[model samples]
Target chain A: MNKKIKDEDIKVILNSMDFDIPSEIDAKVNEMIYSENLPAGFFKKLLRTSNPFIKWVPAFASILLLITLGLIQLNRNAPERKPLSEIKIEYELKDKNIKIIWVKKENFLLRRLKK
Target chain B: MTLPLFFAGEREITEKYSNKEVIISFNKFFIPEKKALYNFILKSVSFSEDSNDIYQNTALRAFKYFRKFDTSKRFKPWVFSIALNEIRKYFKNKIQSSDIHSIENSYEQIPDTQNRELAEAVYSAAYSLKNTEREIFFLFYDSGFNISEISEITGKTQGNIKVILSNARKRVKSFLGSKK
Candidate 1:
């Protein structure tokens, strides 16, 4: 038998039907959410605590770690400097003699010019 | 010097608040709907204990994936999708165990109506439906979901939902008429 049921009639029937909502459901769902949302491991627990100072600890540690790594890399890549005492300054007498001769020649030329 | 162990403890304490926040928000949004959700599950499963278990499982699943939930979209259809999946899983497990008779026994235990013949007829007709049809029927009529919302929850095309809803209403009407 084909009977036409109006959408309103169906809604009325469905709404009129009564079902008990288990009283413990709210508590149970809350408990489930609590248990499921718990921080999974040590790091997760550390990141989500309520204390203000405590909450910044991960951020601090991360920044400190980055600084430490940067310093290590900077130290590794830096050129080694020689100690002042170990640095040798050599005077090549040959070049010194050449310079002296040039000066002597200039002086002689000046003297000749004056004469 | 700050000891490494002390620093680790501080990090643990700090990290816990985000999880706490998620739980707080979940409680705020979900607690208000718990009764409605429980009633829906109860009607869908037609057994208190099964409904309770499914409800708990659904809540747990929802919590586990709560971060993935989009804030812009409505929470109702998303949560209902999870509950519907749990229902399917429950029945699949039951059938695999060859415990189909338990379903029949649970149906027999549906509470008797309080002298409302029409209500009783409607109730029986709703339960007589196949699980998918029953879900669509309830989602549309009782839960106030529109066709698109039903499609989103069930992953069915709108056309398929319309067809199923049409068939479900036909069955209900015929059953009610015969009962009269």
Candidate 2:
């Protein structure tokens, strides 16, 4: 099947395909190039300017600082008081502010009987 | 040698810069190749608007990546690779955004112009081919790249390119012949 269409026929078809680029198209391209307001020294400027360290570094440092502060606060606020079973506490309201009164059961009964 | 000299010395530095220097130096370094690139892209895409967009994208991409370019190599193929990428991107986007029904409906309303009618005929002929065959035939024959270069671009062996082109030519001939 391929043998029937000679080489010349393919050449003719290829030649028939026109590649006419119109002038207005070129004008449009030229207009775009002219209109582009690229930054001064776009390439040299890009290569010369180093990226900011603070963008990632500051963010990382702040996160570490927050975690450290949280850990310190957690340790400081932890309870260190002795267990309530060892020394019993009774509350007495004398003058609006409450006071802690330590009580032993035997001593309190003897004093109450004499009174 | 002379071309390199034109690109190597003071002209090279001036053209390489992107400020007013590029616009001024374009009259020399860029203008001569502009028409050829435009024509190449136009034929490659076969649509005025798409061709123009591809052309602009190719130029901008080429300019941006120019620093990485091997100056010793020919610039035409390098720029062409970019243009081909842009065209591929356009089609991929069209497929992504447009539904199949819309495409079929749009085809029914194809405008009546001589060039458009001829374009429709050629496109229908090309569409009947297998994907690989159509790609190789259009890229090599219609877009005017030789078989060796098409092999390089498509990463196919020369023998494979020949087989694809042979099969594609037969399909296109039959498709066109059936119409008559």
* Poorest lDDT segment (10 consecutive residues) of candidate 2 chain A: A46-55
Looking at model 1 chain B, report the run of 10 residues with the lowest lDDT sum.
B1-10
Candidate 2 Cα misplacement greater than 4 A, ranges: A1-11, A17-19, A22-24, A34-115, B1-36, B43-48, B99-123, B130-132
Candidate 2 lDDT at A107 equals 62
**TM-score of chain A, model number 2:** 0.32
Question: Which pairs clash inside model 2?
Answer: none
Task: Please compute DockQ, using alpha carbons, for every candidate against the native two-chain complex.
Answer: 0.18, 0.06
lDDT of 2 at B46: 42
Could you give the CAPRI-style class of model 1?
A: incorrect
Deviation (Å) of A52 in candidate 2? 21
Can you write out model 2's per-residue Cα lDDT over B1-180, one digit (the tens) per residue? 244422343344445464565456444445655665665555444444566777777776666555455556666566666766776676677678873223221233334554454445555666667656766766766556788877766778999999999898889778766765
lDDT of 1: 0.72
